[model samples]
Target: MSNPNTPKEDDKVNALIEKCTPILKKMTFSSFMGYCGGLTAQKVGRGMAIVIGLAFFGLQGLAYNGLISVDWKKVQDSAVSAIDTNNDGTIDADDLKTYWSKLKTIMSNNLPDASGFSLGFFYGLTH
Candidate 1:
C-alpha cells in the first residue's frame, strides 16, 4: 500500500541523468608562462626602471632647487624644547620625569588603547 500524496522515483529520471555528460578543458604551464612573458614584454619599457627611480628619489633634487621649504631653525628649536621640559637651564632627571608625566597624562586621558583614536585630534587643531 502507497500514500496518495507521496511521489515515487522512476526509471525515466535515471535514463535522463544517464544521457547527460560533462566536458572539461586542460591547461598547460608552458602556455601560462608564455602568456605572462608576452604581457611583461609588452608592458615593460626600457626606461621604466629609470622613470620609477626618479619619481620616488628625485624629491631631494626638488628640495635643493627650492621647490620645497624646510625650516631648519624650527627643527632645532623643537629639539631643544624637548630636552628642556621645565624651560630651565639644564637637562636633568627632573626634565625627563616631567616629559614622561605629560606623556602619561595624555595617554590616560585619551584612552587610546581602548579605542583606536589617536592624538590626531590635537595634531589637526595645532596644524
Candidate 2:
C-alpha cells in the first residue's frame, strides 16, 4: 500500500532513532559517571584548589613588585574614566571581565589554525 518512491513512517522514525540512540547512550553514560561517585567531586575540588593557589601566588608576586599596591581611590577614579567604555558612572567587575573576555574572543577568532607555518617559525626562532 506504500508509494514506491516514499519511505514508510516507521522506516523514517527508525532511521532517526538509530541516529540519536548512540548520542543518548553516550550522554547517559557521562551523566552516570558524573553522579555515581565521589571521584569527580574530589577532582573538581583539587582543580579549584590549584587555581586558587596559583592566583594567591600571582597576587603575592604582584604585591612584591608594587604593581598591585596602588591607592584604591585613585585607581578607581582613573579606571572609571579610562575603562568605562559606556560612560556609566559605576565601575564594576564586569567591565574588566568583559575586557579580558573580548581579548580572548579576538585571540581565538584571529588565531591561525594548526599549520606548518607556526611550527616552522617557532623552530626557526628558537634555533
Candidate 3:
C-alpha cells in the first residue's frame, strides 16, 4: 500500500516539530513567569538587562546597515597625535609604527573589541 509519489502531511508536520522541539523546550512557561513575577529589584535588573541587550543588538544592526557610521579616523588621530616625538606636523608611517610597537609592550593591555571602535559602543553613545 506504499505510493512513492507523495508522503503524508502528518509526517511533514512531525518532521518540522522534531526540528524545532529542542529550541522550544528551552523557552518554557515557568522561566518567563519568574521574570514577570515580582516588582522587586531582581525583576528590575533582569528587565534592564534584557532592554540593554536588545538595544545593543538593534544598534548593531543599524550600524551594519550603514544607518550609523562610527568615526574611526578620530580615534586613530588621537592615538597617533602624540606619536610624533620628532615634532612633525604630519603623522608619518615611522612615527605611527613606533606607536604600535610601544602599545604592544604594555602587559595586560585591554584593547578595543574592534579596530578604531569603542567596545560595546559606550563611547559612540557618550561622544
Q: Is candidate 1 or 2 superior in TM-score?
A: 2
Best by TM-score: 2
Kindly indicate the candidate among 1 and 2 with the higher lDDT: 2
Clash pairs for candidate 1? none
RMSD of each: 22.2, 17.0, 18.5
TM-score of 2: 0.28
lDDT of 3 at 39: 28
Query: CA lDDT of each candidate?
Result: 0.51, 0.57, 0.53
Q: Over the stretch 1-127, how does candidate 2's per-residue lDDT look in tens digits? A: 7677786667877789889998656443323332332344456668999998897688778988988864557756895889876677666677767774564344334334422233332333333
- Total clashes in model 2, counting residue pairs 3 or more apart in sequence or in different chains: 0
Candidates by lDDT, descending order: 2, 3, 1
TM-score of 1: 0.25
Q: Kindly list the per-residue Cα lDDT of model 1 for residues 22-52, writing each as its tens digit.
A: 3112223333333443345335643687786
Off by over 4 Å in 2: 1-35, 70-127
